[model samples]
Target: MMKKAPTPRTALAPGIAKVLKQLHCPLDVMLMCVRWYVAYGLSLRNLAEMMAEPWIEVHHSTVYRWDMKLLPVLEKAFRLRKRPAGKSWRMDEMHIRVNGEWRYLYRAVDKNGNTVDFLRRAHRDKVAARRYFEKAIEAIDADRETPIKIRRCKYLNNLVEQNFRVIKRRTRPMPGFRNFRCARILLAGIELMPMIAKGQMQCAHGTHPSADDQFYDLVT
Candidate 1:
């Protein structure tokens, strides 16, 4: 007898397989919930309610758990295949409330407005700025021997500032994040959404890839 084709679960990447081990939900459904949560301005309750329309029984907290578990895995996969950023960079910070206190979200984009990288920190001091710069350089897979020049003019930073509005709009509806860890995971996913939409990921699909295709490419 011929062997049966490998099941979707069996075909998943080892990292995804490990994270999803023992989960009762179908893989597509779980991924759908995670995608909708980060790609749109919907809360967990909103996602749970939406799923009920299709008769999928899932609790908001379950979705939250999925976010915490799967997002890091997904983000790591995306980073490996991410396209390099442009040389001219713009960086800035946005204020986000977490656990009833303010936190700094440092973000940067290239001149073309592609996302470079992001970091969340408690303080907006020089150390935090330095760390963000380091992270962005690493994210772009830059050559360590080449020095990167940073432009400090206020007018030159509008590209990243505009990018910040997209993130803020998505985060506004939810109640503030419960803690820093939760905020970090969710924010990374949130940052990831636009990058996918803009086709910043290198995939088999040519220049423009639909967000869904890119997301599945990362996970599977």
Candidate 2:
């Protein structure tokens, strides 16, 4: 007998399969909750209530747990297929309140306003800035042949600063993160939403895939 071909679920990346194996909910439901939480200004409680309207029972805490477990794996998969950003880039940092204290969030966007990457750090110093740059470079998969030009003027950085408002607006509804790790993971998912919107992922069918479609594709 010939060996059978792998079904979609079985063909998933090991990390994705591991996460899906543990969840009792359907894949579409889980992803919809995550996308709404990150892509919109809805709190977890709001999400739970919304799901209840459709008669699909889920708790706010369960949504939180799903975000904690599934987002990182999905993000890793996204990075592998992320498209390269523009040569000219704008970088900036913004303050975010985490656990009653303030923290720095380093973020960047290319000339066309495509997201490069983002990092949450405890401090706002040269060391943290250097680390952010390294992470962005790696995410874009830049090389010497195709040099990246970074511009650092208050006026020039307006692009990325404007982009920060989207994140802030989305987070404004929440009570606030309880710890560093939670803030980091949630923020990563938040940032990923816009990148997908900007058509940053390398879609096989076309350049601009719907946000919902792109998100589902990440897991598959």
Query: Which candidate achieves the best lDDT against the true structure?
Result: 1
- Which stretches in model 2 have alpha-carbon errors above 4 Å? 1-10, 134-142, 145-151, 205-208
Worst 10 residues of 1 by lDDT: 1-10
- By TM-score, the best candidate is 1
Cand. 2 TM to true fold: 0.88
Q: Using alpha carbons, what is the TM-score of model 1?
A: 0.90
Cα misplacement distance, residue 2 of candidate 2 (Å)? 37
Error of 2 at 198 (Å): 0.2
Extract clashing residue pairs from model 1. Answer: none
Model 1 CA deviation exceeding 4 Å by range: 1-10, 134-146, 205-208
Q: What's the distance in Å from true for residue 220, model 1? A: 1.7
Q: Candidate 1, after superposition: displacement of residue 77 in Å?
A: 0.4
